[model samples]
Each structure stands twice: as C-alpha cells, then as structure tokens.
Target: MRKTVRVAAIQAEPKWLRLSEGVEQVVELIGAAAASGARLVAFPETFLPGYPWWRWVDSNQWNVEYSTRCRENSMTRDGLEMRRITGAARDHGVHVVLGFGERQDRRIYMAQAVIDENGEIVSVRRKAGLNPIERKVFASGTPNLPAVRHGVIGRVGALSGQENQRPLLTRALRADEEQIHIAAWPGNPEGEAAGPDSAATVSRMYALEANAYVVAPCAVVGAAAWDRRGPQTGRGSGQARIYAAGGAEVVTPLAAGAEGILYADLEIGSAASDRREVELAARPRMRRGQQQAARTATPRRLGADRWAVPLMLGSGPGGLAAC
Candidate 1:
C-alpha cells in the first residue's frame, strides 16, 4: 500500500428512486473527487436509486407504488448501470466503493461493489445482516463471506449498516488484514432507534480495533426522496468521515446531514506501530474459534439459511443449537 493515500467519503442527498439520475450524480461526484486528487471514493449504502426511506418512514405502505419503483430501480450486478459506474471510475483514474440495492431474479440485496482504480470490480459484498423488516424486503447475504479485496491501492473491505456491529464479521476482516474499511450507512436519523451518536461510536471503534483506516459514508433524505413529505427534518448523523487506527478523525467530519465529500490524506506510517503494547490482541481469538469449531464439527445442515447446527446439544461443549 502507498505510504500516503487520499480517499473521498461521500455524504450526499441521494437522487431517491431515480436510478438514471442517481448514476449521473455518482459520475459527477467521481469527477469532483478525482479533481480533488482523491485516489479512492466511497459512497453511502444503497446510493443508487436511494435508500428505502419508507422502510422506516411508513413500512405499512410497502406494497404500494414506492416498493415497485424501488425494485424497478435496483441494478443488476452486471447491468448497464454498473457498467457506467465502472466506466466512470476508469475515466477518472480513481477507485469507487459503492453501496446499492442489488436485484437478482426477483429479490433485492443491500450490496457493495468495490471498483479499483482501473475500473475493475474487485469485490461485490452484500449486507451481512438484515433485521426483520429488512429480511422481508431484502435477501440476507451469506454469513462469514470474505470481506476484504486486493485493490490497486490496498486491501479494501466494506460493510453496510449493522454489519459493523457484528464482532465476528469485523474480526474476520481484521484477520484478512484489511487496510481500508468502508462503513456504509443509510444516514442515521435522530428519531430512529440507531441514532447518530451510536453510529459514530461503532465506526470509531472499528477503526481502532481493526487497526485500519475507516471511510464512513452516510446518505441523507432530501426533497427528492419519499420522506420529503414526512418529518424529513435535519436531525441525523449524515456526514462522511474518515478515521485512523487510533480512533482519531482525519478531518473534523462534515456537519450532520450535510451534503459533501470528506477527503483524508492518510499517512499509514503514523499508525503502523509494532502493536507490541497488546501482543496477544489478535491471537487470543484462536481459543474461542477452537471451541466453536468443536461444537460444529458434526455440522448438521440447517435449511435454506444454510447454518450448521449440532444435534448433540446437551452432549458436551461441542454442541450447537439449530434454532
């Protein structure tokens, strides 16, 4: 990885259900970030066609026109929209980490596509965990899937929403030696359960624990979105920010709900200490892994969820529950 690298974390109002316009805005943002000399740019969760604001605003109305529009706007992994995004990355000579709703067959997933500086998609990871409402709307991503990718700049990985909250998921990325981690969120509205303060805390903690640079991009609901007629007040932690290994903010993050890009010139050397202060910090996890492995050694197959369950529940320390 380069000793000094510049990246752009984008926080902007999504075009909101307008896939074509969203792509245009993305291309424009790429050009703007490239002109500013950022080698990598990361966008918020489901940036294309915008996040499903109705999921929180009025989920009861999901079977309406908005839901259909959302599905219609979702881009396929290899669709024309993705091709255009790749082209933009190549044209600008910059890398892009995009979070968008991915449509496959008839299902949608919260997916992140990591495009390298050469415009090649190095990795496409879906949201690792989905809540009850999300489960109803989006398909769940495979658990324990590889998170990091070998990018032109460095080892880059991304997680959307609650994925950052999963200790095991974050631990897996750390083991992968992720150098750059993108934490994507659909802007934290103040009235929501997971508020802005908590979002910032998790992101900062991830940077510190993973010993990696974090590019957190969040999306805001502007006049163009479904929440426009609702209580779309400016109370949310909707800003792009970057953090170093020591949980230090690179730039004083953009103001909440602000539409802009946060750029950080990362000097990796500053954070690359011997890590001797906590020698067993990374290795202590081995024992816990051994215990879990022992429990799942029998590996009883669970249904569509594809979880491995151990039938020998009360049979010893090597047992796992199916439910």
Candidate 2:
C-alpha cells in the first residue's frame, strides 16, 4: 500500500430531488476533486437526492410531501443515474464513496456506494441501524456489511451518520482492516458526540479505534434551498474535515458550513501497521451470534414493518432535531 494518498470530502447543499441534476452535480464534484489531485472523494449521507431535513422537522405535511419526492428521485443501484456516477469516477481516475437513497423494489434504504477508479461499483452498503424517526423514512439493511476493500488508493470503506456510533458496525469495519474510512453524516451540530469542542471527537475516536484515517463530510441545509433557490449557509452547519490515524487533525476546507471540498494527504502506513497488529484479534471478537441477536431483535425495536416511512408530526421544525 502507498504511504501517502490524497482524499477529498464534500460539504455542500444537495441537488434536492432532481435525479439527473443530482448526477450532473456529482459529476462536477468528481471532476473538481480529481482536478485537485484527490485519489479518493467522499460525500455526506443521502447527498444525491438530499438529506430528509423535513423528517427532522415537525411538519407532517412537509415530511409527507418530501418523503415521496425523495423516494421518487432516489437512485437505483443499476440505474443510469448510478452508471453516470461510476463513469465519472472512471473518467476522473478517483475512487468515490457516495451516500444516496437506494430504491430497491418498494423499499428505500439509506445507502452508501464505493466506486473504484476503474468504474467498478465495488460495494454498496445500506444503513443497518435507524433511529425511531429515521425508521419513518428509510429501511434498515443487514448490519456490519463489508466496508473494507481494495481500491485505487488502498483499502477503503465508508459508513453513514449514526453508524459511526454503532459499536458492532465500527468493530466489523476495523476487523476488515480498513485503511481509510469515510465517516459520512447528513449533518450534525459542531459540538456533539460527547460534547467536546467539535463533532471531530466522534470521528477522531473512530479513526483511533478503527486504526484508519477518517474523512468526515457533513451535509448543509440551505435556507433558500427549502424553497429551491440555492444553497445558503446556515448557522453551525457541517464542515468537510479529515483526521489522520490516531486523531491527528488534518486539513478542513470548510469549518463552518457552506460549499467546499476538504482535502488531506494521508500517511496510510500507520493504519496498515495498526491493522496488522489488531485485525486477527478483532476478528475473533466479532461473534456471529451477536449479529443474529441484533437481527432477531430489530423488528420489535423498529416497530411494525411500515412499508413507508412515517412522518411523526410534531409542533414545528424547531421542535424536532434535524441531522
């Protein structure tokens, strides 16, 4: 594996339910990242069709309206929209880790896809754990899916927002010997995850525990985008940041939200060395029974299998938490 590799994380407003437009925007970002010399590029969770900020809002009407549109705009794994993205990766000569709503049959899962520079759609992992409200919109997939794999830069992997908090999921990723892990999030407050200084703590720990560099890109909710004008920065919105193995802070292009790409040159040798020291031992700790228990208990935990995501109406947007 190469000792150094360049990566990029995108922090921008989503295309918002425009499937073809979303593909174009992704292609643009890929080209820009490749031009900037990034070997790997990552985006925030559900970035293509946009994050369901409405689900976090209390307005059932908006949630109902938006959820349907989001599903309709969601891309299928084998669809032309995805092919365009893969083609962009191939043309740009960069590995892409992207988050999108994956339409499969009648269900939509919060999904992440890893595409290699050769245009091969290598892995598509769905979100396995959903919070109560998230269950209202997206379907949970099988947990602890394979995330680590050989790619352009080296062994790479990706995960959606809350999955970073899931012990089993992260453990599985670590056991897989991931070198660069994309910690994708829809968007969260800066000072979160144990309430340190910034949300970096969440990813910092993830980097340390997984023995990998962390590329955490977050989504931004544009105030005008609510009305479909353009993406304007909001207060305390997310940043595109990266952390080195063992929690060393790297470059961050946008620290306080807006539109930009975060880039970092990582020394992957440390992660490779760490994995060599731990992967075997960690694999033994991952019990098949543990996954079985979670799967068996999921139905009760997520409530009756509602085919459509419910919009648990509340007082207002201010009443519910977005991200």
Q: What C-alpha lDDT do the candidate models reach, one value each?
A: 0.77, 0.76
lDDT of 1 by residue, 1-323 (tens): 33778999998988878899999999999999999999999999889877776666654664356777888899998999999999999999999999998999888888889888888988888775677767656788765455688655777888888788776567768767788899987885552344444667789889989888999988875555654555555545466778988799988987776788999988754343445345545433335555667555664444443344332333445443533
Q: Which residue pairs in candidate 2 collide?
A: 136-309, 136-310
In candidate 2, clashing pairs total 2
Q: Tens digit of lDDT per residue, candidate 2, span 186-294?
A: 7753323445434466788888777678999887766634655323345456666798777878874575656788888887656577568665555434245544443
Off by over 4 Å in 1: 58-63, 191-197, 227-229, 235-237, 269-273, 276-323
**Angstrom error at residue 174, model 1:** 0.5
Provide the global lDDT of candidate 2 against the true structure: 0.76
Q: Clashing pairs in model 1?
A: 295-318
